[model samples]
Target chain A: DKKKQLQQLDNFIEGVLQEALEEFKQVE
Target chain B: MEERIFGTECEYALFHQLPPPSAQGSGKTAKWSGTSFSENLQEMSHLLVCALRGQNRPLAGEFLANGGRFYIDRGSHPEYATPECRSVADVIAHEKAGDRLVQKLVEEAGGLMAEKDIPGRLHAFKNNHDPRGNTYGSHENYLVSPRAMEKIQQIIPFLITRQIFAGAGKIPHLAPPAFSGEDWLPFAVSQRADFVEHVLSDRASDARGIINTRKREITRSGDNVRLHVILGDSNMSEYALKLKIGTTALVLRMIEDGLGDIPAFLQPVQALKVISRRPAGVHAVEGAGSGHTALEVQSIYLEKALGYFSSHAATGEEKAVLCLWETTLSGLKNLRISPSGVIEDDPGELSRKLDWVIKAWLLNRAREKKNLDWSDPHIKHLDFRYHDLDPETGLFERCASLGLVDRVIEEEAILLAMEAPPHNTRARLRGGIIGEAWGKDVEVLVENWESIRIIAKSKVDGMHPFARQRRSVNGLKANLNDPFEGCNEALLKRVRRFLDKCDEV
Candidate 1:
């Protein structure tokens, strides 16, 4: 249960960060 | 005697985060399961102790109970205990050097946790040290003074509202005209949206949306420093719990020890006042999105929102709270608001009702203090119902805004007096009430009213007439709601005389 949760959290963070980075790049 | 934690003082830091949901699996790589938040805290404490003492495996957990001396950079970065480069430059140079060290530690720890597939992303931050991550850390110190607590009470509200004008509404919109098709607060969508999204994910999983309301993780050794890393929802509720009331309470306790006047800069942003208690030299990193590399855009915005308050002013009563509130609200506005004037819409009227109770308490106090009558048109028009109060509470978020906290404290005094002395700490009582659903039971009574009178009498004796006046007024509470709002001037005068009598004693 813990492992599944951690992996899901990592993927979620990666996705959000990737999206934010993309937004920042576009603004520049 | 077991020893007293009442008068000892220490330095400390705090960090709050909204890590992504998917990182929970990273715990698999960790030697221990980082399932529960407390468990993770225990695990990290053990790891840091090991690193600090140069132990191969974990040492006896009793090191925490004993007065062990070892620094800790709480969160996921334990490797910063040893940075590559040694010599330091300016404060920023020192910060950066620490960051360099933490970066390596963060990766190593993350890698180790990942190997075990832990169910959370680890975000760590230390006050004096720099971090490998984006931006989210607080540094603070507590000076042992017989006067620290009193000074805190004098300055709480003024500090939270300090940075009013500059911090708010920075980002115009979430995206360009392409997405929302409207301009919003500058960087609002970038920072807050990301935070909200993170909250929605697995990292915020443990809190069930109650993350922001948790009080400080208190630690005391005479005059002690309490620290916590909270990932609260972006709202006044979060601000109240995380910074306003709790910090004010702690600082007031300090002022009683003769800390005297506070520093000028620290006065405006008092809400951001957090003291981190580590073994001294440990380094940590802070930030939400992305890993160790330094990014200018992310760093600048993060600093503007979170870092600015911690670094802005070192003194003053009103200045500290103001600056802290300004920065906090600016960051909050970035996060979207719920229809019920909170972050989530799940609990419906329950949340709305609680918010109303808080707001009404504030309004009543303000009206009394300002000499405004209850029948005034402004008071009449102002909505006191939970539904209306929810949206109305937003007015407390602006520059020079007196958030609905002081009034709450006054109401709390009434509640405390009613529940009078020789009881558990206020935190324990509030915790039981909020967390346990207990009632106005005698078990929570203020058992030490004699002690309280002793404290109050010793401190308040020949001072202001206002203190005497208040004491007299409070002495007339015959019933639970006897001194409630709208009792008329005749009642107030009577209560005032009664309170004065109490004060005389």
Candidate 2:
């Protein structure tokens, strides 16, 4: 259960990073 | 500085132990070399930078989404610096945001290391001292007028004695060269007590001091001095962090107004060490015209602060701090005078809001259960784990989840702070410019606290640290300088115009 929580946080970070990268690509 | 701005720089280690290269599963009997250590640190730093850059975000400068930033420091430790904030609440929010940011980065790095089949796990702790006698720091910065230097002298005694409540309690360690024999403490109120060797010094690492005299100004103007404090422990309790900064700010305010006569400590550094070791107020110091215990010294300052609050109109936060300070002093006094040596009135109540109390409670419980001595390694491990930043495993987070500790900010507030800056300070503008240029083909250079350069097209100069207006090099101005003012239409329009022009050919 604790590992799952950590995975969720990691997933959240990955998602934010992906979104930011996508936005940068569009702007460029 | 009109309102005291606050910021913190937190340095944290990456790995608990650096395994030798030969110990790796590669089956090569290579001799241990410095390259292994360097390589490990470099890998860690690279992973951290990648995490900070996010998936697709352009690396503009040192700042992140919220008022947080991180970089690799001299010792290969990752250091996170929160953006300047106007209130203690905002500071706490941004500081917690720093913790989240660091945790996220560390987790990502560990995953990467595992993928590469690294030999050891990378564990991070938000604490000051390592077992090898080296010290990291959680330095607190406050923007004060240059004229407040004299007032700083009056506040040193209060700073020395504030450890009774402000300390992040530590398990006993071998005494430093300066302190031994009877002075060797079984427990210390502050983790940084043994390392502080001077009353005031400019050096941070070697020859550390209570009040740092570093004369570097981050602002554009020469009117304000940044009061950099390196004495405090890296606190895990939000309530303790709030009170630590809040009470200090209140005392500084009193000093600036020339409202109280703060007694001088005969030997300030020694007094700091003594009070830190024996925070229950029994240790006597020769100062304030007579020998006074830490409790008496604190009480004197508390009385003067109460007098100032009664006469002056204090803000809601100020009022809260006054009440907490009074209640804390009373609790300490009661604990000292009682023959039982136990807090009888409301057992474990203070533990909810104070780090030292909460830690003492946990340590005492463990000691009774396991029949362990104060210097046991398990006790030290428990102390270290309390300050770990892992959400699922950190002792402080576990206690907070069970409602054993009081929280100063809500979880949602901290989450929001991870992506946005506080509304009422120059950080808002800083965060605004960085957010605006997040994905655009523009260079956002934050040279210092007072100036931001936007791709040589628009250079905004915020000469006054508290002012909201950013004067463009091309004479186009955006006035959002009021620290309390929220986003206004006129300022937004002006900023948009400047940004639009930068976007143009």
Q: Which ten residues in a row have the lowest lDDT in candidate 1 chain B?
A: B273-282
Clashing pairs in 2: A17-B55, A21-B56, B467-B481, B468-B480, B468-B481, B469-B481
Tens digits of per-residue lDDT, candidate 1, B1-505, equal 0111211111122211213445434544354442222235545444334443342312112111011112454443232211111111111122222333333334345455446544443333232111111222222222223343323334322222221211111122123453221221112211111222211122322322101223332333344333222221112232232243233323433344333332222211111211000001111223323321112222232333333335444334224444544444344334333322223322222121122223333334334544544333233222111111112122332111223222212333322322221122222222222112112111112121011111222233434454465554222222111101112345334434434444455
lDDT value, candidate 1, whole model: 0.27
Identify the leading candidate in terms of DockQ: 1
Quote the chain B TM-score of every prediction. 0.24, 0.85
Residue B258, model 2: Cα distance from true site in angstroms: 0.7
Model 1 stretches with alpha carbons more than 4 Å out: A1-28, B1-102, B110-139, B162-184, B188-505
List where candidate 2 sits over 4 angstroms from the true fold: A1-28, B16-39, B55-59, B176-185, B220-222, B281-290, B336-348, B456-495, B498-505
Distance from true position, residue B336, model 2, in Å?
A: 6.3
Give lDDT: candidate 1, residue B17. Answer: 22
lDDT comparing candidate 2 with the true structure:
0.69
Docking class of 1: incorrect
- DockQ, computed on Cα atoms, for candidate 2: 0.02
- If scored against the real structure, what TM-score would every candidate get? 0.24, 0.81
Q: Tell me the interface RMSD of model 1, in angstroms.
A: 20.9
